[model samples]
Target: MKAYLILEDGSMYEGKSVGADKNVVSEIVFNTSMTGYLEVLTDPSYAGQAVVMTYPLIGNYGVCYDDKESNRPWVDAFIVRELSEFASNFRNEDSVQNLLKSNNIPCISGIDTRDLTKRLREYGTMNGMIVCESSFDMAQITQRINEYRVKGVVKKTSTEKIYTLPGNKKRVVLMDFGAKKSIAKELQKRGCEVIVVPYDTCAADIINLRPDGIMLSNGPGDPKENTAIIKEIKKLYDTDIPIFAICLGHQLMALATGADTYKLKYGHRGGNHPVKDLETGRTYISSQNHGYAVDESTLDKNVCVPAFINVNDSTNEGLRYINKNIFTVQYHPEASPGPGDSSYLFDKFMKMMED
Candidate 1:
């Protein structure tokens, strides 16, 4: 069936429909990863947005259960240049088309992804709608696109109830702000008893749990908008518990400590980003998926120090608190569907807990 991706600016691209027959309106962004489309689709961080794949071809290896970052796909829509014709992987259980269709996600193919990505890079991400019908009213569509906004996405994606995964080592209270499953798995692999909690859980309740360490998981939406979460984080900080955070959690941590954050031009959304460690003077290839970054200029150097920076853009990637057992990184160290170069950070968190 014929489909159209209409942006709020009135720009339209025609394509062929490949997933479920549904219309979707949401914030549209792009990813530059050459592989791991499955992981990208299921990542909760993409909760309120449609993703444009900058890579020419997607789903060449097909889909498998073990590759999922979350239980289900969270992307509102998927846009790609071309969908692979054949599923050839030995571990393949389903095709990407079937996976999205089963999840009732709208997908479009045969569009110029390069041009789309370039536009987003130049003009920044915008609200968009995916129409799968034969014909539609352009005026109404543009109005809907312009009026739409992504809000409360973190609460929608976060876990509804607290759950525990038992282990024999140190106890960790993982506050899940729409966390990827791999974050808890990484902690469990190291023998940490993981207690996953919702995004709005209070700091006093967390303290009552008597955790050896605290983990702030990645999530969706603008960091500055989550004012309540930031306040709770400040209360958590007063406890002096060893804390480790990733992606959105890192931004919230900075906000809790009185630092400010700003939205990026197009934001980092690929697996091959390079981040340099300022402390050790080493560079590591990292996996990242975020739209906002901590503003280094707004940081209080007396309380926190920059730890890692992006090699491509020199943006802040990691930070360490002076005289405190707290640190956070702007990239994914678990690497569920990307490189494992920075996985040692998990061990670093464990060492902090040990001390």
Candidate 2:
């Protein structure tokens, strides 16, 4: 079937519809990763956006449910240049088309992804719509695209109740603002019991659990919209528990500590980005997928200092709090579809809890 992609700027492209035959309007962003489409599809951080893959071809390796970061796909739509029809990997359990169709996700293929990516990079990400219907009013669609915004996605994706994973060592309370599963898996790998809690859980309730440490998880939407959760995180900062945060968690911690965050012109959403640690002076290949960054200049040097910065844009990547057992990184150290260069950050958290 035929499909059309309409951007808020009035740019449109015609393509072949591949997945669920329906219409969807969402914030459109692009990921530069050449592979790991499965990981991108399942990442909760993409909750409020439709992802555009810059790679020329996708579904080359097929789908593996085990590779999913969440219980289900969170992206509103998937856009690609071409969809592979063959599965070449031994681990392939199903085709990517089947996965998207089964999940009722709208997708468009055979579009000029290189041009689309260029537009996103040059103009920044914007709201767009994927329409399967050949007949539609352009004015109304553009209006919908213009008025669309990604909000309250953390609540929509967070766990409704506390979930526990048993372990033999230190207890960690993970604040799930739409967390990726690997965050808890990393803690479990280090012999820590993980208690994943909702975004709205108060600091007193978390303290009542008597955890030795805390984890702030990655999520979607603007960081400033979460004022209540920010207050709770502020309370978490006052405690002695060691805390490690990733992505949105990293941004939230910055807000709690009197720092500010702003949206990137064209966000980092790929695996090959370079990040340099300020203290060690070493650079590492990091996997990142966020459109917002913490403003390092707003930080109080005595309270917290920038620990890492993106090598390409010089934006804040990580932070270290003085006289506190707290650290946060804007990239995914869990390394779900990216590199393992920064995975050692998890060990640092474990050591802090032990101390």
Give the number of the best model, judged by TM-score: 2
lDDT of 1 by residue, 307-341 (tens): 99999999999999998999999999998667999
Badly placed stretches (over 4 Å) of model 2 are none
How large is the C-alpha RMSD of every model relative to the true structure?
1.0, 0.7
User: Which clashing pairs does model 2 show?
Assistant: none
- The residue-level lDDT of candidate 2 at 8 comes to 88
* Lowest-sum lDDT 10-residue window in model 1: 142-151
Model 1 CA deviation exceeding 4 Å by range: none
The TM-scores of all predictions, comma-separated, are: 0.98, 0.99
lDDT of 2: 0.94
- Give lDDT tens digits, candidate 2, residues 144-256: 99889899999999999998999999999999999888889999999999999999999999999999999999999899999999999999999988999999999999999
